[model samples]
Every structure is written in C-alpha cells, then in structure tokens.
Target: MRSERRHVLVTGASGTLGAEICRRVAGTGWDVTLVVRTRDARAAETARECQELGAQTTVVAADLADPGSAEFVVEHARATIPTPMAGLVHCAAHFTFARVGRLADDLHSDYLRSFDVNTHALLRLIDQCGRHMVDDGRIVALSSVNSVLGLPGSGAYAASKAAAEALIRTASRELGHRGITCNTVQLGLVDTPAAAAVTDAGVRDLYAMQSAVGRTGRAEDVAAQVSYLLSEQAGWMTGQTVRLDGGFQCR
Candidate 1:
C-alpha cells in the first residue's frame, strides 16, 4: 500500500533469498540497489525481475570478501539512488561443510572466508550505511539456525552467524538515536538453489521432519519476514534475532 519510492540496498541480491527480498520490497515501491559478488547472468535476471516488479534496480558487482567492497557499494548506492539508504539487508553468506578435525584441504582459508563474508563484511557495510542512513532506517541481516543449535558440521558457520547477530544487536543500540533499527533473521533449511547444491537429501529429509510445520522454509517466507522489519509498522522492533525455522528447533 505504501508507494513512496524509498531506497533499500540488498547484498547477495542475485541469490535466492536475496532475490525474493528484492521482489517483495520493490513491489512495495522501494528502489533497490543490489550488491552482487559477480555481474553474471543470474544477477542480470534478478535485476530484470525487480524492474518488472516496479522497483528501480542498480546492480553493483563487488565481492564482499574484499575489504574495500563495502565502501565501493556505498559510493555507488549514494550516487544512484534518489534518497539516502532507508533500508539494508545483508543476505550474502559463504558456507563450507566440514566436521571439526576432518576439514578439507585449505579448509582454514574457507573458514576465514566464511567469517569475512558472513560477519566482517556485514560489519563494514553497516558502518558505511549507518553514516548515511535516513531517519527510520531499517537494517536486517540473514543469519542461520546453526548459530543456536549444535549442528554437527557447522562449527565455523555457526560462529560466524553468531558474530553477525552480536554486531546487529550492538548496532541497534548504537543507531537507535538515528531512528534506525537493526536485526537479524535466523533461518532454517530453505528450499533454494544454493541450499539444494549443498544439502544432502537424507539430511534434508531429517530437517524437514524436525519442523512443526512439517516442511522446509521457502525463500518467500524469509523475504516476507524481512519486508515486515523494514516497514514503518516495525519501528519499535530492534536488536532482536527473529528465528524463522517453522518451529523446527522447538522440539
């Protein structure tokens, strides 16, 4: 119902959850700047989809792993948008599966990379965005249920996600004076192309059964929660990590 053409920047905009968030926010008349790691076909496709949904989309290709990419994105975002960034969603993530002490070759680097993108990169982006955020700004990061549960193969991943949530909590307190709210969404298994590539079918089935809803989550489900957090209705909600696991961990 709102059609103000407010601006939002979404990292990992080419991925499944990211794309869904783009479409949903754009539908509500928000202009979106997609921060992508690569300017690939999928990135173009996502941009096209957001355009069709009536949101102006600008794709800036930069790897979040690079230390300066956050500044680069913020520069492009400032130049391209109509207003200061009103919302930000950090959905980009890097994950590698390996049990402790059974790591693959170069696994240490992989663990470092996971934290770089999932936690440190988010911190960088938040710092830049916070400096230029308009009043009532909303910031949301995509987190994982692994942060809370003792999942067998997710040690590094869990640690990185937990770190991101800590940053979000502190950020909410720091930025509240600017009327900005910061939060994270801790997600469960979602049926997406990215998840499909890494998920073992047997493990997937086990997770699906763990849900009170008796199903895995969808990208749309994650996007819907994010959209609400960005809306004016959620002004009072901040510093919280909302879990969207279909009650999977409730058992």
Candidate 2:
C-alpha cells in the first residue's frame, strides 16, 4: 500500500535554500507552491526545473512580515495552486542586528518585524494551512542555530527565532492527533544572501572554522534535512527542533 503524492508549499522559494527545497520536493513528484515575497528574475527557470521534475507549481506574491500576509498566502494557495496540501516549508525570515540595549529605537519595529515573519506569520500559516492541508501533513520552518547559541549582535533575532521553535513544539503536540507533525530545523551559519552582507571577514572565517566539518553550512544541506523530515520516514518525529548546524553549536 502506497500513499498519494502531496502538495508542498515553500516560502522564500526564490532564494538559494528555498529554491533547492522546492526542487527536492518536486523531484519526488509532489505538487509545489513557491510563495515569493517579490518576483525573482530566475523564477521561470525555477518553475521549469520543478515542472521537469514532474511537479506542478504556482507562484504567489506574499510578504510574510505583513500582518495579513498569512491569509493572503493561504488564499493564493487555495485559489491558484492545485492542492490537497500536505506539507509547508517556511523558509521566510527577517533578520536585523541590534545590541539589545544600545539600539533601543530599532527594538519595537524590529521585534514586530521579526515576530511577524518568523513567529506570528508561521503560526498564522499553520492555522490557515489547516483548512486546506491534509490530516497527515508536515510543516518545516527554517531556524538559525542562533536561536539557542546567543550570538552577540543578534539578541532580538535570537529571541524571535526561539519563539518560533517554541511554537513548533506546542503545535506539534496539539496537531499530532490529527496525523500532523510540526518540526523546525535550527541551522548554523549558512552562506546565503543573508550572510553575504556580513563585512567581518574574521567573523566569517571563524564560523567556517567552527563547523565540525570545517566548512560553512550550505543552503542545500539544510534543505536536504528539511526534505527528509517532510517525508513519510519522519512521520514518527515531531515536537522538536533538530539542529542542522554542522556542529557549530556543539561547542
């Protein structure tokens, strides 16, 4: 007896990590939806890649940081994507640097933006996804290792991400009975557009040196772990944050 293919929605799909995840799921014959906050010039290539892998895709515009964006994401998923939604990969997040005390003025708005996209929007997406998602669905949100590691300049960002991890655990407990499993992968430093802006060469080298594997994390590496968790093999796993940090947090 085999299960049917699932519809998987991936946020931040225009980027390196999210795009790779979309490709992975689509290769498995699942219908994929890419929730893009803004149009990417490479979107057509991405769509072609997914389509070639035997998955249908629909791209929708959504800024998860916006208050009502979750509803809009869901609406677009329902109206535009061919579904029977089974999984969601929440790869969207907002990050900003603040010393927690020195940058007082940036606190309120930064906190709201962080929570809006990283925490609140995730909860909202899960809730809205419930209506269209299958009973045995899976949800995977991308989190940074900083959620627990306490990076010096990213205190608020860390807290906001921690909040998301907490919610994933709680949601897993409540939704487990419905055959739904919620999990978040706390990734270590990865070289994405987010990291590309870091001007500190020494810090960058330090991160690379810290990984047990002696290399910075890759977007695809994190995405691969997330893909497995979304598969039937991970059905027994829920209510936890899996560390995907290449042993950076091991110290």
Candidate 3:
C-alpha cells in the first residue's frame, strides 16, 4: 500500500538547484526521493535538509548515463517510499564545452554523452515513472536558454537540452489523457557551482549585464518555479517550455 502523502522523485539532488527544489517541495508537504549519482556528503545533506523540512526523504544513487539507471531509480523510489509518485523533477545534465565544427573524435564522445544523460535518460525516466504516477502527476525538466539561443561552443549541450524540451512536449500530449502535465523550464544563468565551473567571471558579467534583471538567477528562483509547476494549481498547464530567464532573451 502507498502512503497518503504525495511523493516526488528528484534527479540531480546533490546539485545546488536540485537541492533547493527538494527543500521547497518538502516544505510544501511532499515526500521526496532524491536521485544522486553518488550518495556522497552533498546528497546526504540534501536529504537531511528535506527531512528537517517535515518531509519523509529517501536517497538513491544512480548514474543516469547508464541506460538501466532510470528503471532502477523509479523502482527504488516506489519500493522505499511506498507511495504513488506525484511528480518527477529531472535536473541531471551532462555538459562539455566544445564547438560544433571543432569537435574531434574525443570531443564527439562528450557530445554523445550529453544525449545519453540529458536526453535518453530523461526519456526512460518519464516512461518508467509515468507507469506509476497518479492521474494528476507532474513532470518538470530543467532546460537551458542555450537550447533555443544556440550558444557558441555549447553545441552538444544545447542540442541535448533542445531534445529534452522536445521530449517533454511530446510526453505532455501523449500523457494528457491521463491528466499528467509535462513541461520544461528554460533557465538563464543561475549562480551555481555547475554554472561557475563552465563559465568565467567575464562571461558571467556579460550575462548579468545583458539580462533585464541586471543579475544572474538564484537557485531559489528555479526552485519556486519547479514547486509551482508541480502544484495542483498548474493542472491546466502542459506541453509548454516556460522561460525562467530574467529577461535575458529579450535583448
């Protein structure tokens, strides 16, 4: 038998944005299943924080790049949580800096790796989780503005994100009859360790100056949006990519 509480499975729970999403949803009364590539200190801390927020939390380790990991993750969550999944938040992404024209044999591997994690894993997770989701289930995937803007030297990452958005849209249509809503949040520059790793100070400054908000995004900003998308209030919204950039694309 499943628990009466709503449960959500979150991917990439060790990262900044993912952790924030877990905390926000937990605070809003959702039990959490955190999927991490490793059950490290960071992942443990995230789970601990959620539990403190009054959520029943579980941590599972799975490298999404492995084809079998998605099935394993969904199964584990179901077994441990003993609840019908109310939502799925996919935040796992593989990124590398390589220009489309300059990608050599080794670089090509990174390109494929991006799709393996960002696109293929997402497809599998949606499929696996959808099987167990309640009728009003929510699915939210994190995308990048680069998916639409086509940032230079990020061809592989951009393409993979674009593919993810497409998958979400398709899933929304196919799953609509079941009252499941699927959507993607196209994000701008969020000030996170992952963002800092891939960009320099100069690049970050340029993005801030370009945005209408005159600053980069925060993890809380993304978390708030994810929480909303997962809420019953957003039942009518589906098959759309909501741009959460701070007006960065307006210019």
- Name the top TM-score candidate: 3
Q: Could you say which candidate leads in lDDT? A: 3
What order do candidates take by TM-score, descending? Answer: 3, 1, 2
| C-alpha lDDT (0 to 100) for residue 165 of candidate 1 | 98
Query: For candidate 2, lDDT tens digit of each residue in 10-30?
Result: 888888888888888888758
Residue 76 of model 3, lDDT score: 89
- TM-score, every prediction: 0.95, 0.93, 0.96
What is residue 84's positional error in candidate 2, in angstroms?
1.0
Instruction: Give the alpha carbon lDDT tens digit for every residue of 70-151 in model 3.
Output: 8999988989987668899999899999888766566688898899999999999999999999998999999999998887
Clashing pairs in 3: none
Superposed model 1: Cα runs more than 4 Å off: 1-3, 102-107
RMSD of 3: 2.3
For 192-219, candidate 1 gives per-residue lDDT tens digits of 9888888888878988888888889999
lDDT of 1 at 98: 73
Off by over 4 Å in 3: 1-4, 104-107, 249-251
How many steric overlaps are in each model, in order? Answer: 0, 0, 0
Worst 10 residues of 1 by lDDT: 98-107
Clashes of 2: 0
